[model samples]
Target: MVLVTAPLIGFSGEIIWPIGQILLPVKIGDAEHSTSTWMNFVVVRSPSLYNEIIGRPGVRKIQAVPSTAHRMLKFPVLGGILTLRKQTIAIGSTLIEEGWRALCGLLRRNLDIFALKLEDMTGFSRHIAEHRLNVREGCSLVRQKKRSQAPKRNKAIQEEVEKLVDAGLMKEVHYHS
Candidate 1:
């Protein structure tokens, strides 16, 4: 009897890890069958592995099943039959490939929310208050406190303030009243 040894690999949290393994003897179009046509497994350690196997000819479905029975079984231990269930399958490369770019873009967009400007307390507070007003109208006390410091402004400072206001980080208020 010829036994094939499968390598053990780890799936890191949220990070796409790629792996190279033998292509399972499953065809991509065989997912419609009722029997276990999509039972084969591919060990992955990176995102490229997903790209490699998903484009192959004979590959049917690439799914991620939880590595342990402890995840699925909820009965008094032996009550549930020991069986493997397919959790989710990798569909295409759009989400996997461009995922990092999406995350970085989100971080850059919200960078002002996390930044603190001690020198420009009034402007910083106005920015924070305006953002809070736009997002949560009930939070007014914090914003009022932030706008208490009335400091002198210059052209460069005014430009920076206008930039934040234009970017939706601060509210534009006219001093007509």
Candidate 2:
């Protein structure tokens, strides 16, 4: 780390001075599927709210797509896509004291209602939610023309379906046309 001065503005209009900057090798995702790059981090002499904040530069360097709603970071790796789960959830900044506590308490109380992973969720059932396409009355059923997909795409789709099936979220079924 070298001595440098760069002012960083906080969320609440607070100016924070960095102690220095260091070029460190940062790795993202698991060992089986991952990406890495040397990043210059601005060292701050203050407590951190998050583990690490990767800005647009870092995200672009790794070619990652972060979805705040899904709470996941996705990037393309050698063979397939790699996804990293984020534990933190964003809430309204205006929430304070009782509101924050109440929200946390409510989540804790309803822990069973939340499924962090597909495996944690209950098996799929028609009772939970169901949908049916609107078909015209007295219309003959027409089968769409059969199409073939690329081998790579077929393999990927099979893998995803298998994963869902193994997790009990999906089931194999056959319908006679």
Candidate 3:
């Protein structure tokens, strides 16, 4: 196969890191639910780091990608990310559109916010592309890790995740952290 470049369009994202961890579900004893492991395995947790940075209000967006260390491990599963082209913007507009609809449906919100059509997400995508929202710059806790079920929530979480995956709102990806 061959590779090539193309033009980019719309986008959107935050200006700084988030207040969570990229959790990797690890099975301990097969007792059902699994425990989680974090990448970097740092002493400085994300919440405190977020608190430190939150004082900076001018931040517009934030995102994180695989660290060079993690990516260089060079596992087969990491190919999609390892092959990421810096010049192109990968915006999940359909995901945004679908999420907006789902949020509106569940909340039954009828505010001006409801007027955003799925197609319009492209206009927003421009901002993400132009403004560096799609790029994972510096160190960021931009991605949120979620899983199938918990011992408490059971199938509810699984059902929700399945619905999201089916709707193309999210993807089930393999991550080390």
Off by over 4 Å in 3: 1-56, 59-110, 114-152
Q: Comparing candidate 1 with candidate 3, which one achieves the higher lDDT?
A: 1
User: What pairs collide in candidate 2?
Assistant: none
Q: How well is each residue in 1-177 modelled by candidate 3, as lDDT tens digits?
A: 122232222122212222333323222111232222222211222222121211111111111232332221111122121121112112133336656666547435433222233332222212221211234556555576865656777875577567545644456555333
> TM-scores, in order shown?
0.16, 0.48, 0.24
Give the lowest summed-lDDT range of ten residues in model 1.
124-133
Per-residue CA lDDT of model 2 for 1-177, tens digit only, reads 988766997654457788898888876655466677998788888655454578898889889898766656788888899776544322345455766777778668756444656655444443322233446777777888978889997997688678767865557665344
Candidate 1: give the clashing pairs.
17-45, 17-46, 18-45, 18-46, 19-45, 27-60, 28-59, 28-60
Ranking by lDDT: 2, 1, 3
State in Å the error of residue 80, model 2: 1.2
Going through the candidates in the order shown, the clash numbers are 8, 0, 12
lDDT of 1 at 170: 49
- Candidate 1 similarity to native, TM-score: 0.16
Q: Write one digit per residue (lDDT tens) for candidate 1, span 28-51.
A: 211222212333344554444233
On TM-score, the leading prediction is 2
